[model samples]
Target: MRVVVIIPSRYGSSRFDGKPLAPICGRPMVQWVYQRASQSSRVETVHVATDDERIRAAVKAFGGNVMMTASTCRSGTDRVAEAAERLGLGMRDVVVNIQGDQPLVDPRCFNAVVKPFTEDPSVKMSTLAFAIVDEREITDPKDVKVTFDENGDALYFSRATIPMGRDGFSGYTIYKHLGVYAYTREFLECFRSLSPGRLEEIEKLEQLRAMEHGHRIRVVVTPYDSPEVDLPVDIRRIEEKMAAMGIG
Candidate 1:
């Protein structure tokens, strides 16, 4: 089955307005995401799925594919699902959801998340997680944390520091959940039909809806940590990282 990468973007955001088109190193943020996602060895195609015409135009101007989705779409996953349908993807095809905010995402992360389905035909959903090297991320709500079972299936993803020590916090390896996700087109349709869970609403995390419905999410640990842009202030930091990594 083919692997498709869809970057869902919106013009309006509570924190940062017009985030997808925001300039980072003189290029729209979505361009960086699209270009990096295209670099994936396993990805067959990449598309920007959004309801806003501005995003569509920007993507097209950069010679990238764009699909217009409904503005009423509930989440990025919903947008990706609609785009997948438009692309005529089959149930067994792999669909990778990469957020536009992650301009510096590593191409290898895309391959890593899609690897599970390649190894096991039964695998439906998978995501990337990076172990916390920065202590601040453990308590930062913006950086979602996750804990997985011995088999690498996610146990729970939360904004709070999980497995809190009764004595003191030390030597705990917290894993930060990356926004990148891969799903079988069949499971994506199932995900769209599933009702939102209480925990999902509380955490504001859509992945919880799958867990609440007894779906197993395989977590792939990647050495690369992709920093997401949540505000205008984060732009400088991204540019700095870009320079340090020798990325134009």
Candidate 2:
């Protein structure tokens, strides 16, 4: 099965417009995401899926592959699904959806998400979650939380602090959901057919829709923390982090 990485980018954003073209340390943010995803040994090819001509041109100018998707696509995942359909990938082929906003995503995280499929052919969908080491993140609504079953399948995902910690926090760990995901082409099609769930609508998390529909989402614990650029102010912090890591 071939492993293809698709980064869904749009020029429009309520918080930061034209975010894909925003420069960070000389290179556009989307370029950084594309370059980092290309470093993964498991990914066969990386493509940027965008509806905007500016984003397509920027990606092409950087010598990266670009796929034009429909502007009506609601979310990044929808754009990825359309792109995968256009590519005519096999049902078993793996598709990794890496968010364009996450410029600090670790290359190893890609390998981690793909491992579940390699080990078990029955695994249809998988995602990455990191241990919540920072206490501030536990209360931060921006840091989405996930709780999985003993089998490592995600039970629920929410923006609020889960498991309530009412009994005092000990022996349990709170995991912050990362924006990366991996799925088979078949599952992607299945996901598209499902309607939004009540919990998903309440939490505003798309992943919850899959869980609400009784689909199993394997949660892979990753050590790396991927900070996404949601606002224009986040660029400076990402640039500083990149510089500290000796990345240009």
The lDDT leader among the candidates is 1
- Model 2 lowest lDDT segment of ten: 163-172
Off by over 4 Å in 2: 167-171
Worst 10 residues of 1 by lDDT: 163-172
The TM-score values for the models, in the order shown, are 0.98, 0.97
**Per-model lDDT:** 0.94, 0.93
Candidate 1 lDDT by residue in tens digits, 44-91: 999999999999999999999998999899889999999999999999
Candidate 1 Cα outliers beyond 4 Å, as residue runs:
none
lDDT of 1: 0.94
| Position 81, candidate 1: lDDT | 95
Candidate 1 colliding pairs:
none
Model 2 clashing residue pairs (backbone): none
